[model samples]
Target: MDHQPLVSLITVNYNGRAFLHGLLESLQACRYPHLEIILVDNASADDSVAFVRSHYPQVQIVENAQNYRFARGNNIGMARARGSIVGLINNDVVVDPDFLQPIVAAFAADAELGAVQPKVLDLQRPGYLEYAGACGGFLDRLGYPFLRGRLFDRVEPDLGQYDTPLQVFWGSGAALFLRKQALEQVGGLDEAFELHMEEIDLCWRLHLAGWRIAVLPESRIWHYGGGTLAQHHPQKFYWNFRNNLFLLIKNLSANRLWRVLPLRIVLDGLALLNELVRGKWRHAGFIARAYLWLLAHLPLLMARRAANRPWIARGAARTEALLYPGSIVWEYFLRGRRRFADLKYSQAFTRRLAYGRHLSPTQMEGVEQPYGTETV
Candidate 1:
């Protein structure tokens, strides 16, 4: 309960009133004092706006005129936050009562740590940790985000196995703790992303700026999991794939891009063909356009990367040796286990966890989503 406040927890809501209500209630139960809660509603049609206005009078609200989508919505809320630290928790997630304090303390404990994500449980299945961010997230060489507790759709159960706090390539936005200075230095999440993979883009910018990211095991949150793409929304597919391709074009060095983009493109072609065979026309279009979009907008992405090149190229640290991409990515989709976790320092290696602390009443093993009464 410091006077200036320590962290501002922001949640973006879109047609998920019941879920946001639960999420806010959990925040109400949190032990941290001097916390500011900002709820950005993406033009909900139902009683969501009215419900929060009537019930949660104490929370700050930003009611957008129309759906700005997740990325823009969060960017709006985050920019308005007054605290030095910002907590980006999904509206569909519920945090443990003891979560915020430890996370804030961790930030206070280390000046270099730019961001941290809490251990996340899957609400739909209590015993299984959510794949979105089991103990933080990582990217293989190809820009695929696979959490330590999960690789793709494969999620592991928690049994006090991953008990220690660890550093991660990127923190999960599901319940991420971020430094405001870093956001100011790099700007908030990319509005171009519109959603999906935006957090990775933000973290990579932080890394280039010499900030560290970590997973705080002491804090715990349970996410409903894949709230946006629950059934493959077109916007979801488009943003996830497009932003990933953009990540490569915008962040990777030119030499690296020229060396490996062709293989990645081939993989994407196969994915598009498979989607086309399944009659997922939009999905296929998404994959096809991801590359086309990159091609069309190469000038802009190149300009952005060129602006960043000077900062990275001038860094004293060696950049080429630890830069592992295709091998790590190939393992994520083809080999399953992260090949670099055992290696320690590889210019950029991958790491994942399969454990987290449980907080639900079930006291069960994983990500359980018991909605009390609400249905999907």
Candidate 2:
């Protein structure tokens, strides 16, 4: 940590001209000495590239001939990145001046650390946690990803509840920090994902390759949440459902995959049924289409699974050890556990090692409460 390592900050933009000023302005105030900024423009219809060229001439620009969406756009930028540490930041996010320092320090502290996510607060809502990634991300037994400070639609207020740096299942894509070596080892974000859940998929591979992912709460950023696709967008639903299945297929061990996947499909069917009962035809259609896509692409998914087997065998840790043993969906809806603290089964997650250290329930005291302390 004697000398600052060169850090490349890459942001993918698509018709995000209006958001560039805030993001670029905030980055200009960053305290990090060795910093490189790159913007990957995905054929933005707006004058986003021209505006950056006119205003921020120091920033590097990579223009795509057509819209490559999130995953591929980021991959393109990362490929052009020269720094040892590369960051994939969203165009709509604004960071704290000292954010890059902590991220760099975390990487310097742990050689196995593959990725890190800063504590993300909502830009519009002040102290509330951002919906995409609050204080890192964790997955339930069923492959449902949720955050420490935000579960489903419930986002917690940033009251220093999760201030400690802790190991997590995945880092948020909105403002994820990555080691260039790790990216090379596991490969870039899956282009097939195109958008949602791609970061989770990448982190899952990192874990399988014996790399650690964590949330460094000391560094922070505020996100506008949905810049390209709105929360309720039909495409978002399709990608979330479809890519989640892709995630499980590609990463889950053979012993667990059979048990978990069928249950996940059943849950998706229940979700589709609920939407149908509510007369939400579009939502139901999206879910149904996800199933159809799965059926049509079974061979492709099997190939991806076969490709990832070596990494899975190389990993010393069990994927299930890092996952919450219970169902997040049942705990949230059926048991009425809204806050992350209210979930009793979270205590089971202490079995996993984080950042090369064993973390017991006592070690994660403030971050997670003891079981049965609160009731519905």
Each model's TM-score, in the order given? 0.84, 0.92
Over 4 Å off in model 1, which ranges?
1-5, 231-235, 277-279, 314-329, 332-376
Candidate 2: residue 164 lDDT (0-100)? 67
Error of 2 at 297 (Å): 1.6
Model 2: per-residue Cα lDDT over 62-140, one tens digit each = 9999999999999999999999999999999999999998888778877777898999999989989899989989898
**Where does candidate 2 stray beyond 4 Å?**
347-376
Which 10 successive residues of model 1 have the least lDDT summed? Answer: 367-376
